[model samples]
Target: MSDFLSKFNGENYQEWVDEKDQKKEPKNPPQKETATTEKEVVETPKKEQAEPKNEAAKATKKDVAKKTADASQTTKSKQEQKPAVPDTAPKKNASVHPTNRAQVKQEQKTATPVTATKRASTEETEIDPTYQKKKKRKRILIGAGTALLCIILYVIYYNSVHVAMPDFTDKPVTDVTKWATKNKIELDLKQEFSTETDENVVISQEVAKNKKVKKGKTVSFTVSKGADPEEILKLPDFSKMDKGSVEKWIDENKANGMKVVLEFNDEIAKNKVIKFEIKDPNIVAAEYKRKDYATVYVSKGKEVFEKDISVPDFNGKTKAEVETWAKTNDIKMTYEEADSNEVEVDKIISQSIAANEKVAKHDEMSVTVSLGKAIVVPNFANFTPDEAASVPNLTVRVRKQFHGSVPFGGLIAQTIEPGARLTGKDETEVIVTYSEGAPFLKDYKGQVVGDLPRLFYEDYHSKGADINYTLAYVDSYETKGTVVSMSNFNEYVGMSYLVTISISKGNLDQPAGYSPKGKESLGDLEEE
Candidate 1:
């Protein structure tokens, strides 16, 4: 059947021609005219079959032969009128047999639908004049839609990647720094002295607020550094200011080399400014800057009567009068007694500070008071040797004696009577004696043996019996001439008894050429 269709199509179907057949064939006719011709050919036989049998028999064989040739001529013209299909349309399996009606019917029933390319070509062949306008409109709409979609996606992506610049004016720099850190941006910070803006606050920004910016972009902003030191600052008139105001000013401006100095001034009152000067002598105090060195001198008031004072004459004045004068003048006075034949007793003889000599208040002064020509001896009874020896204008001599009534070491007697008065030109000597109680031999260990005899004699002698002691030397671990031991110490010995004592040689081993200085009685020892 396919072979029969191929043969039929090769002879009758001009629209399904291959490239080689198309090259040989003439241009085809309109598809509508060809379709009209095919319809007439198909219906002519139908018309003959539908006619009455007598009418069919009346037609002659010649008429039938002429009708068959006309039919052939009509079929060839229809083939010549077939419209050409585009080269892009499918051509395979497109042929059908015309004479085999049953085959044609079966093929038409099983044939694939017409391809869009072929349909389009057929439509184009009969297209109206407005078709190109409609097609151009559709193409323009598609291209515009594609471009709009791309722009929408780009906007979404751009918004996600970029950020808007924030307003930084009048805000703390810390805020700007924090925002920059969060956005992974770099900051180009500049400092400017602003009178209106506070320190560490942003004054201005290079980028305006709400403007788009990419991440990691470097932005420049200016931060305030408080007021301008050189422009806004002015030095105050320190000469007319008090110490407190000047000091406070110095403290506030000390970083700029301002200071205050205190000095003693006789004219200006205490704590008042005497003068002010800039450290650079060429720059006057009135034109000083915050960074200029300035000094304000404050007065410490007059020093009159603060230090120097005239010494008062104390000659021939009573001690009471001199002390009163010293107390009133705040002078330190030390008194001493001197025997004077000219001045009266208890009167000031002389003063260490000469008459009208200059001296400071509270300065020490030595004053000498006169004791009259008659020097009365003080009572030595119950007085120790040291107490007796401390008397002024008198020399004291000490001696020990045994007494039955006086306590041990108490004063016993003095050579001159206690009330005796003597006219002495110089220091008068007085001898006072102390009691040793009852005389007894004493332990002399660790005592110097050289004074033993004198001690015993003084202790025992009282215009009566005199005690004596004998001495012996020995090699011992004690200092030379020091007593190591003594005999008859615990006995009830009285005066005039002979007591034995041992003296150390200061070495355990005796030396060569050493002589035995044998035991000697007190009388012999004293004589030697």
Candidate 2:
């Protein structure tokens, strides 16, 4: 039973031990907790370190998000703002986008600081747009200012360096510009020796000083250093002075610089001075002081004379007697065969010097008595046209008349009579007549229109025949040297013929026959 009681006690003791163990275990647990707390405390520093790092990472993330948000906000604000349009809008749309333009502008604005920072960081930086633009503008202004200053400096230098010159006229050289321009004259300067003006100065002027000259007119002046030699005096003009006055003037002016020389001139009247001369001739300088004398020439008046003297009849006088009478009365006589067949030969035909005129003592007298014979007339009829016209001092007249038998326009007879005594210097007249033959038609060819009829008559007249002729023109022809068609009355009736003849003796190579058109041909003719 003791055993049984021990077992119960053991159980009860174990139960009691269990209950105490629980209680004791709670206390150990507290000690273990304390140990755990100590272990945790030991690990707390590492955890603290990790927590601070995590908190720092979170804070950095928050700050980065704020910065991104701020940047996005700034971008959105900028996007919302419209760029101001320039007043002068582009005609065409610009190629750059507004955003790109704003970005470029923003980049420019931020470029300086960025560059500075970049320079600080990297030690090298690119130039900024603003700085570049300001530098470019400054350079441009400086260049422009430099150029302007250069121009101003050039002007100042030019003005300061100029020098004033003297007036041209007051200088040594004479100024001919004014004189030449004013007078419209051409100036020609010539060098000469003169005392009147300084060296190279104008000594004398042509056309006188201050005289108005026409354009292209010549003006001459002498420029010289010294004077010239004296000139000889010139002879005086005495064209209308009397002979005595001229001689007296020459004698009285002997001391002056002139000498008289004498020569006879038939053109000048007798006892008259024809011309004079200076004793010594030379070119004189300006302002020469000398008494100038002149030789004089005078004229003697015309010779005296009388006309109309009484004729001394030489009818009964011999040749010697007539010669004596002619010598005493200053008469000239010539004899020829008388025109009257009944008159005797050796008689005077005519006298040239008239009777009873006052005559000079040196007068020549001539007397001619007739030779007792009839002289044959010279055949002047066959003379050529020129020879016929050159009959000197002989007057001739031609006329047309009518004859019943001779050709109509033939020479009839002479008035003074051919082969008759030609008395004195009187002209002989010729009378021509026309024949009474029936009219023959003439070929009026090459006759001047105005002179056809007269020329036609003359053609036949020169043939020593006369005829009635009617002219007809075959064609309009030109007039040449003479008329070239006439009728022949002797034969070939009703037949037309051509003839050429000169109409008048005056027109036959006579000196005054035809008017000349030029001086070359008119030299032989008389002047009007």
Please estimate how well model 2 matches the true structure, expressed as its whole-model Cα lDDT: 0.42
User: How close is each model in CA RMSD to the real structure?
Assistant: 23.8, 41.7
Q: How many pairs collide in each candidate, listed in order?
A: 1, 21
lDDT of 1 by residue, 267-340 (tens): 99999999977789898645666667767889988754555677778888899998887888888889998777
TM-score of each: 0.27, 0.22
Which regions of candidate 2 deviate over 4 angstroms?
1-233, 252-346, 349-528
- The lDDT of model 1 is 0.65
Q: Of the candidates shown, which would achieve the greatest TM-score relative to the real structure?
A: 1
What C-alpha lDDT values do all the predictions have? 0.65, 0.42
TM-score of 1: 0.27
